[model samples]
Target: MARPSTAHLGVDLDKAGKQVGFISIPHSPHEDAWGAVRIPICVIRNGSGPTVILQGGNHGDEYEGPIVLGELIRDLDPATISGRLVILPAINLPAVLAGRRTSPVDGLNLNRTFPGDPAGTITQQISAFVSDVIFPIGDMFVDLHSGGSSLNILPSAIIEPAPDPAHRRRNVEAVLAFGAPLTVVIDNLGEPRTSTACAVRAGLTTVGTEMAGAGTVSLDALKICRQGVRNVLAHAGVLLPAAAAPAAREPEAILKIPGQAGFVFATADGVFEPCHPLGTMVRSGQEAGRIHHLADPSRPPETLRYGADGMVYGHRQPGRVVLGNCCAVVASPYEGSLD
Candidate 1:
């Protein structure tokens, strides 16, 4: 059954200039019967032009996106743009506040719940509101992320070729404009419920990133996050070029990760020891990592290896792993732009 959408924002999105408010998801808990979960949002409009939706903190543990978007929320003004820019610094408030990958209220991964339910869990309701209400207003959508608390990454962007050729082309252009040090084309891994997948289905040019992680943020990661977002804004014509826009990521290497072969998973619960670091180029069948049985120190470790020749782009975090956990991901050789 199609549940009635209950999420609402406290601000008027149609108004011009900068407006600050919150998307209030009604919550009737034991403490506050009528209190709502407020997700901070900023809508900056200058006349009438393309609408770009910038979303960050999709995963609560990812810090770079939230940090940079918070800066934009506080510092960005209305006079600098030609179109509309809607920014959500911490979209998943419960997860962000709890410092986890899933929402504390519902224990659901926001990324996995797209085209959401109105009368479902709190997280699902938020996703439904965004997908049903806010997404239609966007001409382009950019979502930023990293490895979050569970992994470390190589400051890369993920660009999936949309089923529509036009959408695919536009998305690819947006990803290039993002200009991350490394951009990749990957299949959606058969998951069509992700933010990227949902945006693509909506025919919106979408771009997302997996910049850096280890349950923390970094100065370099912030710089990359800030620059990439600005570049996309400039490219989408939402932000006019400054005296000099942020530097483009030169010498970028584009790779493709097609299907499950690109990933390395832990077969048993153990400590993962990686043989190669992120950004390392390795040949097929190479030793990617090994899982050691810390519980039984005398037992020999079970080795893990790569399935193909590619560049290592992501790895599990904290050197720990559980059975069936993804330990690493590799991408194929560069086939796109250089600078």
Candidate 2:
């Protein structure tokens, strides 16, 4: 019923040793009639075990996932692992190359085009290739992401709400195994058109991350991303425990974003001034920030207040904001049990 993808893979996924290749997606522009966008992928296999799919660069500006996954593709010895590792460091090659959130080829957000259309735009075609060609063979999916150029998010690992309790529990376990300083149990964040959603719907254990973001990469976030990938591999049995040095077991805070009220948004276009930094504890109705009206200096600055009580999970990065732009998001500690 679905059209076949116009993408070609140069690497054999079932191959024994580590093989590096590209997923060539056909393209035709005014400058060239027959051109292709080559997305780099690496396949590492040793023996029989669960296959783990690791990916990054869903957004052009987020650099942590691509950096850590790139290093893994180069340094990870296939012989030390029991299963396969299908790594796509820069899944959205066009966006990564352009350093923009959406692809320059089609001006579409790859994240929102899940289980995509082969007959659609370049972004949709890429999504279709990943959904059709990739998701079917994966046992677990790990997508790394940062806030990109928009927000500064606290370092956290996120697990989506699954179809069943058992599946949800598996995702929760994966988040724990990921061992990020902040673990978030999300209920889709009102956006279902994501790679994580695609993987989860296909019954794969999915774990995603929100490493620090703000256009520039953070060293602290990089450390978490690097170690988190290894932790997930070790947890999935794809990598031996000895091969991946685990982080010191510590009691990490598990949080959940309360729907709607947890977010603070700009009501009008203006320059924003935050009252608190991320990780700060605040109460509902508290002054979160203020937006100064530049067009009319006489108008008093609008004071934005929190709608929910929790830790400041994320906030807008740039000083300028437009109407409906998210200014801050609060997350409360999750007391519910996944078990």
Candidate 3:
């Protein structure tokens, strides 16, 4: 028997054996005044074995993952693969094209609206499509992300805790396969709307990765991310394992602090001169940076201090600062499992 033709939009997959194509999900209808758009999903499937997905551009500002995935798609050879590999380089195409953080039409953060409603906004419709069409088709999921906008996150993989111990083990194994220096295991803190959180809730092992800063793609970060993706494929038994390079050091557990504790912001608008750089260690109450009043030459710069003993993970880029803007983030050690 001949294979069935699976065609949607401009993507066609040969479903006879292993097919790779695009699936069009319904979007909000557009009137003559406003036209509806159809979201196209790129799917790569092998006839047999497990299915893995690589999604990027969830936050349009984070460009590394999408660029890396684009390169991977051009270079991938499905003949040697054992399972399905679905790569969606630009999940939020509108945001990516506009170079904005949120969808220009809806102004919604796609990441925060997973498992969304079909009748909701355009973002919700896309989320519903992913949940209905993509989630159940994959055995493993890898949602690629990076620090959006002003944040610069270290290259790391984040895995949410699975109820099943075996699934959790697999999740960790998959993250280890990425070969990133840092791996953070988190349990949803009542934030079940995230894609990773939803995947775990469905009993599927998922891995979330963050690489480089936002707004631009770093070549060094892209190289590391590509290697990580290859490593994941190899680890999942979809592709043959090649000689592995020297592994980076394992990451320490991340300690997420209470978001309600108002972050110390600049009291005066001026140039922010940091007393310490990123990755610096500080004790409780140690001075982190200083805010100099550029407008007044006579006033002394106000010293910024840490609230607890921890490592500096995030800080604002050196520039003119405004009053009431966050200065830096310190990562403190967690005494117990941070779930």
Candidate 4:
């Protein structure tokens, strides 16, 4: 049964046309009584076929997905597509506008609140609409992401293994089809409330990404992100003449993050100085970074070391670090050229 969501979609998904709409989020704040936060959404449908839901701006500071999606919404046409293309350039309107990772309004992390409560806060309502309304309609999903203000990461596509072997295999295939330089299968760190998890519960294949970060978008990141979208669409049968992409891209190198053993965290609060760059291989006991006590020059700097031999897949963006902050993340290599 489809519940009428508090978040309203402004367009008809069944109609064979292109339309721009908003997911109207009700907000009655002290400033205004009749105001609503409108999140951008677009639908392009030519005929009956698979539906692909593409979104970015889950975190306000991440630019790769939002940049690529905004361009897609403006340039994509209904006649060119065989099925339906749903685009949400900015999924979290409050956070996106505020340029923060979480919604400044309710201090909610949208990604962490999925299969949400319709009667909850603004972010929860949006999440509920996506899980209940959007997930039901779309056959495939891509929620793009980046490291945001706190981290810089190698361009990668991330997927969690489905419980079923066939579903797991197909999900891997989709990640390969996206053809990012690095493909990581997260073995742990389950985000049960994510849109991808919602899609999985509905038995749909999904692929999400972690592109360039540090809270800024680069031309190179956009180029790969746009191509990845095309590759996935062609792979999913939503776009015609798959040759529109390169005959073939170099196969992505598969990596795996095996639980908490895969990360290095800072124990002391200070300014962190990284010893390695993204994609660098590190040996166990090697110094990942050094935390300097800016306030106390006499105090010896604390050095963070790798506990396992692996590639440095992620790093904090800002040099400053705090106790318990993840300083670097490592991933075990699987196969293929990392070139």
TM-score for candidate 3: 0.81
Tell me the tens digit of each residue's lDDT in model 4 across 154-233: 88887756877777777777888887888887644876887777778878888889897888886777788998998888
Question: What stretches of model 2 exceed 4 Å from their correct place?
Answer: 1-3, 245-252, 335-337
Task: Write model 3 residue lDDT over 1-339, tens digit each, in one string.
Answer: 111222134454324233344444444445334344544345555556677878888878888888878876777666767777777778777787777668986899787898877667767766666676667777888888876675666666766667677887778778877887666554435577888887777667788887867456767778878888888878777776772443544334544333423144677788877677666777767777889887788999998777767666566654677887777766555443322
Give, for candidate 2, the lowest lDDT window spanning 10 residues.
Answer: 243-252
Instruction: Give all candidates' CA lDDT scores.
Output: 0.85, 0.90, 0.68, 0.84
Greater lDDT among 1 and 2 belongs to 2
> What TM-score, computed on C-alpha atoms, does each candidate reach?
0.94, 0.96, 0.81, 0.95
Task: State the TM-score for model 4.
Answer: 0.95
Please provide, for model 1 over 1-339, each residue's C-alpha lDDT reduced to its tens digit, 9 standing for 90 to 100: 234677777888889988989999999878898999999999999976899999998999999999988888888888888899889989999999999999988889999999888888888888888888888889999999999989888887778667666777788778888867888876657787788788888889899998789898877888888888988898888887662255454323568874688889998988999998788998778899999998899999989989878889889997778888989988886564322
Candidate 2 achieves a global lDDT of 0.90
Q: Top model by lDDT, which number?
A: 2
Q: Which residue runs of candidate 1 sit more than 4 Å off their true CA positions? A: 1-3, 243-252, 334-339
